[model samples]
Target chain A: MNLVLHNFFRSSASVRVRAALNLKGLAYEHVSYVLRKKEHRAEAFLELNPQGLVPALQLEDGTILNQSLAIIDYLDGQHPEPALLPESALDRAWVRGLAHAVSCDIHPLNNLRVLQYLDQQLGVSEEGVAEWFRHWVDEGFASLEKQLASDARRGRFCYGDTPGLADICLFAQVANNRRFDVDMSPYPTLQAIHDHCLELPAIVDALPEHHPHAN
Target chain B: MNLVLHNFFRSSASVRVRAALNLKGLAYEHVSYVLRKKEHRAEAFLELNPQGLVPALQLEDGTILNQSLAIIDYLDGQHPEPALLPESALDRAWVRGLAHAVSCDIHPLNNLRVLQYLDQQLGVSEEGVAEWFRHWVDEGFASLEKQLASDARRGRFCYGDTPGLADICLFAQVANNRRFDVDMSPYPTLQAIHDHCLELPAIVDALPEHHPHAN
Candidate 1:
């Protein structure tokens, strides 16, 4: 099976998928699409992903899948090694809750197009856009920190010392947050988890800097 | 097995999970936390879900799981009858893509806190907040319409005739859009799917008006 990951270097969503694939010990080809150049929005790319989003997985069968969360969930289902989810229902829910807090809540607000929309259509100034980005990140991280702080299951990683789906989602977004200069100090637990995930070989290899599109 | 669903009537996330539970032919207990009254933000609820969000499911073993997506996935995993996902990897991805179009992209932007943030902090007028809500919803539906139009697999539902995860999600959010007064004329495919899902006995029973908090 020829698995091709269509992604951009700096896309947090793409980075998360890469981390998941690597952590699962899956070997796949990488196809970089420079999002800044509007490559994802081109007609051919849109044919692959009507949403014109990055981190689309093109299977050997030529089927394309979009949406980072769904793509990762499918990957976890297909490859159970170093299982991304916890063994029990409650634990699985907590891990998934952490992942969604970042994916559905925080990252969605700071998505490239969202920022562009804020600036261009909403007439938000540059500073205003930055504020908008940071505001959401802070709100999400605050709750995430609270959730992680008191949990007995949290180890060196987001869940029980293993780099699960929540860790993948959180690490990528934390990297993005740093790029936007959002403070990590408020969320000590998240910062600790992010630091730990970055040290793992799979995550390090999947870093945005390793991508072809990276400068 | 006693399954308790903690939810808010108008919350799209809660509605999606409720629809799924009902579809699975499961007998569950309903627990209401009124969002408008800020009951979810109270200390006890916060302990259950630090995110202070609706749709936390308590399993038979007395385990609590938060996040609508995760809870629904757990339900599907436990009760495999009338499976929610397609048989193949690609097909599953497509169904999940449809779910994300609403859960990840459109719904997050118009979430209750976000609208409140726009008004209280960003100083957006009520009219401006409504416009922002409608804009993102339209953007997502436009993309979804194109995908649905191009696919022959779409039956009376979002995916292959079954009222699955995607259908449950889209049905709930479309209902929310109506409450927000967002126009739905542009996306005929979405409207069609929404109409079909509402006819299902489970979805009809899961209607927001059926909840205790509904006005």
Candidate 2:
């Protein structure tokens, strides 16, 4: 079956799916959309994804899957050699809980669209937006720091030794955090896991700079 | 095995998990946390969940599962009689995509903490918060309406004849929308599904007023 990934470089959500594909060693044709240019807003693109968002996975039969976590889970289910979710249901929930802490609790608040809304609609200043972004990152990371530090299952990665869905999500968010200059001193475990994820050759290839649209 | 749910009556996220538990016909002792009073922030509560979020499942084995979707998924896995997710890989992704659209895109922006941050930190007027809340609900619902309308799989529920994760999430968010007077005219399909879901005895029993804390 053929696979196509319509994505935008430097988008944390898109980076997440890319990391999953890389981890599973799945090859797909990458079609880039430049979000800043409103390329994602084009009628044709919106037809593919009504949300007018990136990181849509188009299957060979033309089924389009939206939402990074959903797409990642789909991929893991289809190819289970290196499972992204844990073996036990409870352990899987624990790992996914951490991933949601990043994706839902932290990233959405600081996403590019939300920041743009704050600036254009609410007239928030650059400093104000930065503070807002940092506020959420700090709050989420504080809980993550404590949870990971306390979790008996914590390994070199967010779960076991392998970098699973949690690690992929955390890695992507950390990249976005660095872009906004958010302080990372408070999350040593996060930093270490992110570093370990980056050490993987496949994950390195999925970094934003390595994407075709990064130029 | 004994089951206990720690939840908040009015939290949309918590409501999502409660709806899931109700769907599985699982019996659990309920422990309610009042967010307005900062009861969830107490030292004892925070120990169970570092994130200090409501709707954490404290298992009979004393394992705590955090995040609404994660907890719901764990229950679905353990029970498996009535699946929250579909059997086919692709179908499961579609349902999850709809679920994420609510849990990630819409609800997080209108959540209590975010609204409180706007009021306390950014000095946004209550009117401003209402507008902000309605804005996201409109944006998210517009796309979701388009999606469910366009897809051939539309049934009595978001997926099929039975209510599942997507329906549970939509029902909770629609309840929140009504609370804030967010106009629901634009989403007839969503409204219809929500109305159908409320027709179910278990689902109706899980509504906010049924909780002991609602008085």
Candidate 3:
């Protein structure tokens, strides 16, 4: 099946899809969008994703699927090698719950659109925006720290030894923490997971810096 | 299998789980948390869900799982009948994409905690908060309307005639839109689905007014 990915270099959501593709050993054409320039808002891109979000997948049949988790799940469903989720349904749900802890609860607040709203529309100061950014990172990280440090299922990654969905999100969140200068001294388990994932080729190539349009 | 649902009566996320349970014909013990009264923040609740969020499901073995979508996926997996997700992998991904469009995009920023943070911490006025509320609701509703209205697979619910995960999320969002007084005239398709869902016993029983805690 032909696959094309429309993504922003620095988007946390896009990073997950990139990592998923790399992990699954699926090859795809990469299309970069310079979000600051409003390239994603162009009519063509909107036709692909009405939500105007990045990390949309265009399948061989011209069916476009948006939302990074959904796109990753699709890829995982289509190509199950090095499976992204656990075998048992209960275990998969637990992993997804962990992923959502980061993606649903944390990332949405820090999305480019949300930050832009805070700045351009709410007239928040740069410092205020930075504080806002750090605030959410800290809140989510604290809860995650407690969850992961306590969970017996955690190994080298957020789940087992292999890197998967939750680890991808944890990796991205760690990057965001570094970008925003949020304190990492509090989350040792997360730090270990982040470090473990960075050692992998799939995750390493998917970092924002590896993207063609970084900065 | 034993099941226990820990939830807030009015939470959209919790409402999704409630609707899912009702649809799946799962007879589980109902454990309510008074979110406004800080009942969810208690130590026991935190033990169940480290994040202090509600709609956690306790399994027969006493293992608790969090996140509404993950819980639904778990339920659907355990009880195959009345499947929450479609049969084909691609169809499932599309359904998941629709669900995330509501759960991850529209609901997160409008969550009770986020709203409280905006009002108490950021000092956003009531009107400002309502504007913030409507802004996200409109952004998500516009895209969803475009998606559902354009899809040839449109039926009685978000997917087909079945009231599944996406419809549960859509149901909660429609309720939220009404609670916030967001204009409904613009999203005719959503209004129609909302009306369709209200006719179903499962969805009707899951509405906030029918909950044990609603004022």
Candidate 4:
């Protein structure tokens, strides 16, 4: 089966899918989009996803899948070994909730478009925009750290000792946080889980610097 | 099983849960909180969910599930008679993508707390806040309406003929939109789906006015 991942290296959503694909032992071709250069907004990429978002996956049947969570779930369903989600439905919900806490709540607020809009339209100073970006992210991470540290459900990873869905999302987002110089001292459990995830080869390869767009 | 839902009537998330419970024909006791009065932020409620969000479900074991999506999924898993998700994983992903498009993307931006922050802290005027709310909602709904209208996957509902997870989310958010006077003319497919969903008895019972806080 041929899989094409259309992504930018710095995009956390793309990174999540890459890690998921790597974890499943899947081979795919990478097509880079330079988001900073407005390449994703180009007519070519817009045809692939009308929303003009990155991390669009082209399947063997040529059906393009948008949304990182949806794409990861699609891959997980087709390739179950080294499963990204937990076995039980309840466990799955918990892991998904953790993932959403970052993907849904935190990431969107600090995304590239939003940051650009803040600078270009809102007249916010660069420092102000950076502070605004870090604010929402730290709030999310603080809650996540509390949940992970206190919840009995956590293991070496975000779920079981295995690197499951939540671990994949957390690892990628934490990497994004570090780029912004967001303080990690407030989230010890998150740091520990991230450390565990980095030991895996799949996650290591999905690092931002590894992608062609990172330059 | 005795099902009790702790929620506020004005909360869109609570409305979704109420609709789901009604769809499943489960008799649930409503434990309402006055969100505007700082009741949800009280120690008692915060103990249930540190996030202090509405729509926390009290299961038979007194286990509290906080996130609205997690609560809804738990209900679907526990009571599978009238399933909220589709049978195939691909269809399930589609349904979830639509749901998150509203819940994660639009709702969070225009949430009460966030809006309040814009007004109280940032000193944004009432008109400015409303404009901000409408901008994101319209941006999200435009894409969603196009997707639902063009895709063959859509039947009378967001996915097929059944009123499933995505429909529940759409119905609630559209109802909230009315309060902000967000124009629906731009998204006819979304408007049609909203109208169709409201036609159901479950949806009617879940309207914000029925909640304890709606006085």
Candidate with the greatest TM-score versus the true structure: 2
lDDT of 4 by residue, B21-89 (tens): 999888888888887687887888777766566788877777677668877887898899689999997
Each model's chain A TM-score = 0.96, 0.97, 0.96, 0.97
Give the TM-score, chain B only, in order for the candidates.
0.95, 0.97, 0.96, 0.97
Interface RMSD in angstroms for candidate 2:
0.6
Q: How many clashes in each candidate?
A: 0, 0, 0, 0
TM-score of chain A of 1: 0.96
Q: Grade the docking of candidate 1.
A: medium
DockQ for every model, please.
Answer: 0.71, 0.90, 0.81, 0.53
Q: lDDT for model 3, on a 0 to 1 scale? A: 0.87
lDDT of 3 by residue, A1-215 (tens): 67988998888899899899999988888888988889998999888888788889999998899888988888888889999899988889989999999999999999888999889878888888888888888888888899999888899988889988899988887776666778788888888899899899988899999987677
lDDT of candidate 1 over B3-24, digit per residue (tens): 8888888888988988988889
Model 2 chain A scores worst on lDDT over the 10 consecutive residues at A176-185
Model 1 native-contact share = 0.74
Q: How many backbone clashes does candidate 1 have?
A: 0
Alpha carbon lDDT at B156, candidate 4: 82
Structure candidate 1, residue pairs in collision: none
Worst 10 residues of 3 chain B by lDDT: B172-181
A87, model 4: CA deviation in Å?
A: 1.5
Off by over 4 Å in 4: none
Model 2: CA > 4 A from native: none
